[model samples]
Target: HRATFTFDLTGMASKTTNSRGMLPDMRSNLYAAVLAGLAYPGINGHPLTEAYGVRQRFIAIVTDLELPNDPLTVLSTCDECDRVCLRACPTRALAGEMKQLTIENTSIPFPLFDTFACDWAKRYSLNAQEGPQYWGVDESYPVPENRTAEEVVKAVTRTDWGVQKLHLNVAEECLRVCPARGTR
Candidate 1:
């Protein structure tokens, strides 16, 4: 959906009903105030217009909203908007104080949060087994079946090839569970 623009599927010039969306659903909000927070905070005294590099980039948008020119107001979600994402994430990447794994850490894997990743994981996770079982197994990742625990630790912490291997083996489920509310 358009973040600031709307289109009429019925071919009306504009919507006769609500111009912006009515309200966000309280049950399944995925933004949880972090990634979504970044969208409108107006980094460096400008606005998301600067940070997002586009006038249109937004997060957790259930439908197009009538955000005012004031960027701070864009973050006002209703109370009790259940952050299913906090519960859904296998990793505790989000925080009570700090939220979200930076793109530097996760998007190479999971801060890779995108509408497509979330939607696909939701569909794929229904089968459970179909989703990768190694949900939070980042620690055990570098070690195979026969490797000892000490060997595993040594392999994972080193800056050598083992670190690269661990990075490669990281699961991205943390990013995939967040549902996207708007079109990319």
Candidate 2:
């Protein structure tokens, strides 16, 4: 038996006390994708943009009980609104073209994104264009054109602020500006 649970994290998106404070949804999004993929391989387990309409934390459990497979229903209203998430990304992480991921004959279409760029803006909150100033962060560290996890870590650690300021400020413009939250 496989079961999936979701907990809404939209309420915390406005909090700015720490970088992770507003990142529960993003973290949970990844968790949900992994859990779902493991529980139901070959199904639509990939993270779809429509699912972010409302930030949700997910948990999946597999038991020894027989259960019927239930199709996941996602009520997405993104088609009606302007693509604010794409435009709001300061690092142009979400600027890539749309791509499709197919699993077991199920084709899932999603926006292509640069993980490094997204992480640079969200984890460090150093992109002034993403509104780090709102969280009282004055320093705007330039994001390297060729970004990598190692390089980003080195840059952050070498700074006077160091890792202590890692959670001081964060940007979630894409999630914050999503109009799908209202539907929830």
Candidate 3:
């Protein structure tokens, strides 16, 4: 069995001091998923979505009960998109390539990206070009051309900028501007 929890972030203010107001929403969805898992007694679930904000969490669950295969419609509109999501990345983390992953004999194609660079820009709010200016975080740490998880962490810590405090900024521009979701 599979479950999907959709969070609609439309009409919400983009810039905020509280992690763009996503933590609470994420927690709610997480709790729901947990409860659902518990109710199933002997179910195992795995999350499929990577990005935060206005996203769907697809949980592929396994159970003893037999169920019909009801595959969700793939968003083929991404193929026709102008690649706005890729261009919106302040760190240019998206590789602009489609990679396929086969799950349950179904091929899922998604855009490839540098996870380290993406986390640096989105999670840490390090990229000034990505609206860190809203938080008064003017420092734009350079993403290593060959970024590793360790190197990204070092770059953030080595800076004189206070790394301990929370730096709030609008993130997930790639997800926000996706025409597939009608967000554009």
Candidate 4:
């Protein structure tokens, strides 16, 4: 038997509303915070993003059995890259360099992620002249073009089908090319 714990760290200190309209579900700040706090193996060592990509979700398991924890990753795998992730970002989401902020007296460093652009790419594919591709032509759906991120978010949120379609798609190119977790 085991117990589990979940945290809504979106309001922790430095987190803000993300482009996807998701709070804690959008980025991995809370996971990183937890890893840093517990001195556990960080995302950098994970096979998926090599610590360069944001964690998707986190859950803590409490068991009665004693077990050893994995050693903490002291170095970032991204430090060895030639900025490939930044260049591959479709929305330039993770392109910004590190920026430090003092939140609740604690200095925290993070990237200036552009949620607007990130959400756009995730919800709809950009077709050079046709604009937002919400559905394929075979579905008799017309794609919207030149719409702002806010407009896309509003439209996508209006229907269950829209929400499902957007959520089901994985459009982040940067997340797809990680040497550790990606198909590269």
lDDT of 2 by residue, 1-184 (tens): 5554444322322122355465333533443353244211111112333434345444434456785654443333554657777787777777636555564465544555676676676666556555556645556566787667777777766555433445565546776666664333
- Candidate 3 residue 71 Cα shift, in angstroms, is 2.3
User: Which candidate gets the maximum lDDT versus the true structure?
Assistant: 2
**By TM-score, how accurate is candidate 1?**
0.26
Off by over 4 Å in 1: 1-38, 41-73, 77-81, 98-171
Question: lDDT scores for all predictions?
Answer: 0.28, 0.51, 0.48, 0.42
Point out the worst 10-residue segment of candidate 2 by lDDT.
38-47
Q: Which wins on lDDT, candidate 1 or candidate 4?
A: 4
Tell me how far the alpha carbon of residue 145 in candidate 4 is from the true structure, in angstroms, after superposition. 13
Q: What does candidate 4's lDDT look like per residue over 20-108, in tens digits? A: 55333334334444343432222221222334344344444546767665433333455556656567665555654666555445544
Tens digits of per-residue lDDT for model 3 on 16-89? 22453543221123323323321110000111221322254422343566656444333335545586777777
Clashes of each: 5, 1, 0, 2
lDDT of candidate 4 vs native? 0.42
> Using lDDT as the measure, what is the rank order of every candidate, best first?
2, 3, 4, 1
User: What are the TM-scores, per candidate, against the unseen true structure?
Assistant: 0.26, 0.62, 0.57, 0.48
lDDT per residue, candidate 1, 78-133, as tens digits?
A: 11235444555443323323223444233211122222222222222211222333
